[model samples]
Target: MEGNLAAVLADRADTYGWRDRPLFHSGAATYSHGEVHDAGARAAGVLRSVGVRPGHRVLIALPDSIAFVAALLGTLRLGAVAVLTGPELSGREHAYVLGDADPRAVVCGPGLVPRFTSVPVLTGDDLADEPASLPDPVPVPAGAAAYVQYTSGTTGDPKGAVHRHTDPAAYHEAMALGALGMVPGDVSFSLSKACYPYGLGATVFFPMFCGGASVLWPDAPTVRGAVEQARRHRPTLLFTVPTWYARLVSGPEPRAVREAFASLRAAASAGEPLLPSLGDRIEEVLGCPVLDGLGSTEVGHTFVSNTVTRRRRGALGVVLDPYEIAVRGEGGVGYEGRPGEDRAAAAAANAAGLGAGGQAAARIGERGALYVRGPSVMIEYLGKPGRTADALGPDGWLRTGDLVHVDEDGFVHHHGRILDQVTVSGERVLPLEVERILGQHPGVVEVAVIADADADGAGEEAGGGALAAFVVADEVAPPVPVLAEELIGLARERLPEHKVPRSVTFMAELPRTSTGKVRRSALGRAELSRNGDGSLR
Candidate 1:
């Protein structure tokens, strides 16, 4: 329990009191603690045979199956860094990650063999076929690198966030205590791929830490698939994102599914912000609190979480005690920004608002960025020394590019991406704020706000950009006139007039990443396409 993460996982398996119970469930393929531990040993043997030594990075690009879990555990068990790339990523992207990491070997599925023919490849299926035995757990420091998670960068490249072996265990111990309150005999299911740090924490580590059962699958494209698995397994808990929840609530009558989930004690959401309406709908349907937590790959897991006992519909809940949260500006650290700065800027500006546990939310005055100083923070960005130094300062504080503010009640509100802020008519406009307000409308299911040239405005519109919004509505096309009126009205009331969106376009669905974050640049191009204008296109 005190050594490396692989040791911790093995320790939990032996002493957590549920070692004999089912640890994973893939359709027609169930693996218990002993089976999984043996599979990890076999995977380690294969990796070692391929010249993967301690501290060497090994790329793992396989589907979510028992093999995926085994490979991850095996890599860690060998003290090899697991470069976890998603199976959904393009071959080029996979190559980028593999090349960056320069992995000693790759343990992937048969489908990925062609991409990296030069490197030694060991299929997860092949590893499963090998004899299972208890391999010696690799000796490593608690701070040794565990895995790499590549996040899409603003420059159209992917940046790898590296975590230490101790990170995931910290996540399972802290976040699970507050979010799941899980007990022995609990059954948990996660829709996120095991390769994802969040999924690894919520789906695998949490259950193991709590002495519960975890259900894994190869894939679940449709929410119905998730519901069917939940119904069949009668899992006591489910962890997923808001987009998946939205799809589920919007799908077929969920009465039976809801009733089947009667045994479920807690459900959690992450990856993206959960709309209050979506949370309400799920709560009404399943009669359970849909908890939400905000985390990033750099942080590894949920450090700031909204607990089930204190659920706030729209707010991103309070910060968990395991880490310290703060915001900072070039000038100083504080909470509540100076006057004339945007709402986010003013709220988070120049103030060092400390949480109950002495963790500070440092606010950069008037144009401040969010900063975090916590044990959960990543050690470094893999293979990118310059980027790592830029993000993690000499003081050990991590710069989070999200612009945010803390209210008097100590709730942090996300304003927008630091790069997404636009200046419209000489005033700062945050697309996320406008989009949040627009999303509150009953007719609107989702919305994305962007900046475009103001074709109609005369003087200020000359070569200048204005705000535009794209919406996906449920009932009828959101009355453009009413949408325009309400959006402008809401902006004027809650924000400056210049921050209001001038144009609105209704679409079937907004563009989103696989993880559910809206692609604002894509939405901007879509707006140009809708206008039938070649200029912006």
Candidate 2:
């Protein structure tokens, strides 16, 4: 971890000789690297004037703008932790976060000024009124906290993932750009707001690290808005979630959207498992690979991904070497077959032969569960020690609830979540895998899979519930029979016969959380209530 993130940005400005190039662009304006550096300095002066000390928390709720960029750098230059939140956080969530962080000051647009009562508020316009230069970087220790981003919480209270000051620079330099093959000229755009970790990394630091341009559109809720932004800016790369992509592709040809992205070298999807067919369709439509990677807010950025060189339909690619990932089970950490020791013995034992892309099947084995140790892991869950310790072990290996297996070639394949796993006719099934396959159908726009139960605990309610599917389709007619047959066929092809969906339902749309993820628990409960005989309840 570097002492401070500002040093990294400054170093990029010098090394890439991009001091004169545009770093931030919007529909109305553009700011060069030198101008951005100046604005950051000025914003730092405003922070200093406000008595912002090193280690102070400054809640920033500015919309994406030049001032937002400056305020970000300003917070870091002052060695302060910036709480990046969207302007439209719910009043209750906003109040809870403000009280939780107890920031020394809160900066936002005038529209949100009245909501923050605990701390004095500063507007972006006010910062612009002040000189637009920042002080030199303060030396923040490598272990200093940089930001606190909230993550999805099942317990009703939002949880914060505290990132180290240096994690951003390290992640951008060592992992995201270097590992993902991001070059100096790469233009990165993200639909997620900067308050989120994925959006921050993809939009802010990814471009800065490579001396590339970062595109931010103020209007981003609708497909048309995103398409307009893309048409105007023509980003070389896009980082978006599955929901937005589904919406974009489901609409008309989106020809302007496609043409704008004609120069796109790479596209990435996250926030959930993208249907492989959706990925293939995106590649076919946009003429670029829609690489899917996996990460959580706690993990900072994507640690596993489907790279261009070695793309796989449903795999989240190999864990980058910088990260130490192990599939732990009852035995211990599973080891990949090292070269020269077991190849001949395994070959002699298995001549029927699974070759390339196929490997021996195994359960969660003695390794226990998925444990990851790396610089990218969050330091803590703010004030939730019980939850933190339950997930993060003493060895710095975080126990991701996901159960997976690394094949002989060391590629990781995701299984169902431990808590959400189901058994059909004695075979364990991962609902996400089946959902991904269902989402590939031409008519299917989105899908959610859940276990359905009958009330009397008889018939289909044998083991909690049988598998049920909820789907939303594009203009194409609902392929109910075709979908069921194809889904069953896919299950048979990729999984044991028992894991296939017993029934499928068509819906106008699957329910979604505010963040655009399908709410499986909601769907599960709804299905149980809808199908249950009432005995289970």
Candidate 3:
């Protein structure tokens, strides 16, 4: 615990005796535990030769491959902070991150060298020439800064969440050991790339902690590629987002795809709410439980999750032990005790239609802002003290800005983000609620609801804004105009009058972040005209 995060490789090799066991696989090549360790040490030497030092930041922008892992661990071995970013980031985004982090050295492929004219650039080819011997590992305090993980920037400019050296160990214990029940001989595959927190946990930390191996795809993971990899590698666990799960179930070959997943013991979903219908489909097809949970870059990895032993279809499982969750109202009134309290009392009070204070308590059991406090949470957002202070409250409680409710069984249900809540006709509406109802339609493959300002200055007369839905239909679905009317009828039957979408537009696919969460901010600005009949034009 006193050493840098790189020590996990050696520690696992010692405890599990997996020196010659495969640790990483991409395409036809495989790297054993010992080989990766040696490669990391050699890469550390290369970084040292380029003047990387303790506390300095080293930007890692490479595809998901052995070289990316080596560069990350090598930086950690030297006590330098590894700044992880996707290789597919736009040039402007790359320039912003480079300027913000001001990394001392950059580790990337030769093709990306031209982007770092101001910084020291060390390509993978440079690491290839180094001696393949273990370099002396640098000793750092357990609380020393280890890495800088940037947020998805779906709502605003991306901010870097700074994590400590001990965070990885904490996440390993909470997620891998406590939640996942991982063990040796279990192969793991993740659709997420190594740059993100979820992928880092699945592909790097969990496997290392449990003495398992991970599959890395150099290219972006597609539905077909995922099934093919599963069939070939025979992994025990798979991690991905809800969007991918939906697409996989709706793919061309459902039976063959299910057969491909026969090797999987459990599958995990996050990044977005997992519709109960979608979860059931996945479980039926994969013949295993689909565990859905929630996590963020600020927490390093998952803090609340469902276990195979006790699974919930739609709800995020009980908060992992040693971590606490509190459902607080908009005014910061939290639940009195543990989340799983008497549901009878809560329901009775709400049924009575009580006054101010009683309504507040009732809402606590139904919906409120979520606050989390735990060891795995980040110390701060690098270089943004004001934003960090806004997120991290007094006494280590992090205001997650998510609207959630805790059921009597201690299960937490996500309503949506507080920022995502929009007022329509003087009533607050959560987009996820609308999207969830629309997602049940057979013709709808994906749906995102946004509040659009009404045209013709009708906002004050009808409501503050109008509700519009961006939808992705099934491959064999009907024409857009026909599907739009069907979706509208379905919404009228299931949702309230205000919640029903006033207009619908079809898209080939909903725009999403790299991690697979829908980009609602982008959808809010999408241009669409209202037809004479109030349908989308």
Task: List all candidate RMSDs to the true structure.
Answer: 5.3, 5.4, 3.6
Cα lDDT tens digits, model 1, 502-535, are: 7667665667665667777776553456543211
Which of the two, 1 or 3, has more TM-score? 3
Name the lDDT value of residue 236 in candidate 1. 80
By TM-score, how accurate is candidate 3?
0.92
> How many backbone overlaps does candidate 2 show?
19
TM-score for each predicted model, relative to the true structure: 0.87, 0.86, 0.92
Question: In angstroms, how far off is 489's CA in candidate 2?
Answer: 8.8
The local distance difference test score of each candidate is 0.72, 0.71, 0.81
- Point to the candidate with the largest lDDT: 3
lDDT of 1 at 249: 65
State the number of backbone clashes in model 1: 17
- Which ranges in model 1 have alpha carbons more than 4 Å from their true place? 131-134, 252-257, 335-368, 453-463, 475-496, 526-528, 531-537
Candidate 2 vs candidate 3: the TM-score winner is 3
Alpha-carbon runs more than 4 Å astray in model 2: 131-134, 154-156, 336-368, 422-428, 453-462, 479-505, 525-537
Give the alpha carbon lDDT tens digit for every residue of 296-320 in model 2.
7788887777776666877666566
Point out the higher-scoring one by lDDT: 1 or 3.
3
